[model samples]
Target: MSYGPLPKRIDPRKLAEREVRFESSVDVDQLPRLVECLALPDGKIEVDLQFSVDEQRIRTIVGSARGDLHMACQRCLEPVEVEVAATFNLAIAASEEAAKQLPRYYDPLIVEDEEIELLPVLEEELILSLPMVPYHQDCSIQTSFGDDAGAVDADGAESASEKPNPFSVLAKLKGQ
Candidate 1:
């Protein structure tokens, strides 16, 4: 059965005991928080994760997710394909205090009332793993930061042409 964007929360302890491995993808459009940041929202995250119990009986999750995202290239101002991947080794925590006490090797994935919010949890990880400023590895883009930055209005009026640099005064105040 398809496993992702799971309709229900999973009991980590039981899954850990069973050694259940979930392989699935959640549609990007299905997650609003995730979709908003995407230039192209019709995509999916490939999830290949599993649950297991550690020697200390601590429930753990280990997995990686890979996917393609369309983000505006910081250098080109054009759509660029970004291959995003994130690997997580997490130990489930029973309480806020317990999360802090988790070992340095394993990040804590907080679980409350015996359940977890799977989508946002994973989405947050993937999102955090994304590059703060994404760009093409090799691209030919000529960007201009000079006077040509003048903007035009819908009626074809040159708004920035000879406009007394309104924000320029702010620079003067900084020295005072």
Candidate 2:
């Protein structure tokens, strides 16, 4: 979604408030890093946001938003549905010290005509909520190996067949 310019000057003396809702679609291919991790097929991003502005040292803003994205399974590389929801509070300060009093992660957003654009910040928050590991909760893939295998020779050692790199006496010698 596109947002208009924010108010150029926010008068600390006056209380400024605004509310907006936006909807937009983002191409999965545009997010190359996230796509590499998810390996998702072609998909779109859906977002819903509700935000308000209040006066603080400079101006304070708060918002709540939710998003839906399509992800790919880590195990079988299949499509999976993912959802994210978050609540945020932000402050725009005239000085660095005033900004520091607010949240460290708060970004300097646009303000115009006593209005602020929150869509960009909301999108970023949604991106941060993505899971480190994206996989289906109930994956359908199965392997032939089961849990019946027991320890080799009763010493709690793995079987020879299970060794990642098996040793061979003949192979150890350079020449025989």
Candidate 3:
């Protein structure tokens, strides 16, 4: 099914009161912070959000974001395709005190002027979902620095290195 453009800002409390369910796709270009981490910032994020008042009588937003992103591979230093996704349970809070008082299960979305910027919140969720060191499962590049066989003698015994240890000089100086 087709979805409309995402609204830039939203009043969470009002939306929860009305029990709104919002679904949309937003271009990656709209979220600068999320784009900065990507190898190629050319993708669309699919968002689904349901606003309602939970049993605790607190206004809440239950949402998920999904996207195909390209992040630089740490092993090969090339663009690697990655799937990013996140689900969030957020409680609307009017102030810092209210935010701190929220339950552990709900992340606080502190609102000012009864509205919050939607793009940044969504961007944060995507960013948090990204891998710290993204890389392909089987990278094409060979990352081995030295052959293990070369470090062993013909009899399959470990051999001392032919190169002198740089730390040996420090040890000699300490002995003197």
Candidate 4:
């Protein structure tokens, strides 16, 4: 996949009667704002978009995007390879006003007489699909707190052999 400029324009009215296939890839750096949260690897997005335009509205956009990212694990704070695969459906209308009248979610991509670029929209969609707390399925650290590990219990009491809190005995004497 190659990261390039977006098309000057995509006439939904012209595509109303037909389907279009948009296959492209975009570099993460090209989207500076979105790169802040995404731990993007040196990779390009592989997108296979298939959709139709109905009059001035994009009816159904079904596609899949695959890419690799480097993100820190939420649990261990270690960097890990993240494989992203997202499938999405979007409706593009002429304007936000027109979309507001629609029942489903709609994104307004204005079409001028120039090339219409889908990179921005694609980036937004991908960002939304990202996991809030990303972690490896098999975490490296062990989390189980066994009794022999000297962990405190729910009642704020340590194991019998553990060091006693001096304040506890003081509190008991005061109670008497």
Off by over 4 Å in 3: 144-176
In candidate 2, stretches whose alpha carbon ends up further than 4 angstroms from where it belongs are 1-58, 103-118, 142-176
Query: What lDDT score goes with residue 111 in model 3?
Result: 89
Off by over 4 Å in 4: 1-18, 54-60, 105-116, 142-176
Sum up the clashes in candidate 3. 0
Estimate the TM-score of every prediction.
0.75, 0.48, 0.80, 0.61
Whichever of 1 and 2 has more TM-score, that candidate is 1
lDDT for predicted candidate 3 compared with the true structure: 0.86
- Stretches of candidate 1 above 4 Å error? 1-7, 147-176
Backbone clashes, each candidate:
0, 6, 0, 9
Clash number for candidate 4 = 9
**Clash number for candidate 1:** 0
What are the per-model C-alpha RMSD values against the true structure? Answer: 7.5, 9.6, 5.9, 7.0
Worst 10 residues of 3 by lDDT: 148-157
**How well does candidate 4 score on lDDT at residue 119?**
67
Alpha-carbon lDDT, every model: 0.79, 0.51, 0.86, 0.63
Q: List the residue pairs that clash in candidate 4.
A: 6-117, 7-115, 7-116, 8-114, 8-115, 8-116, 9-114, 9-115, 9-116
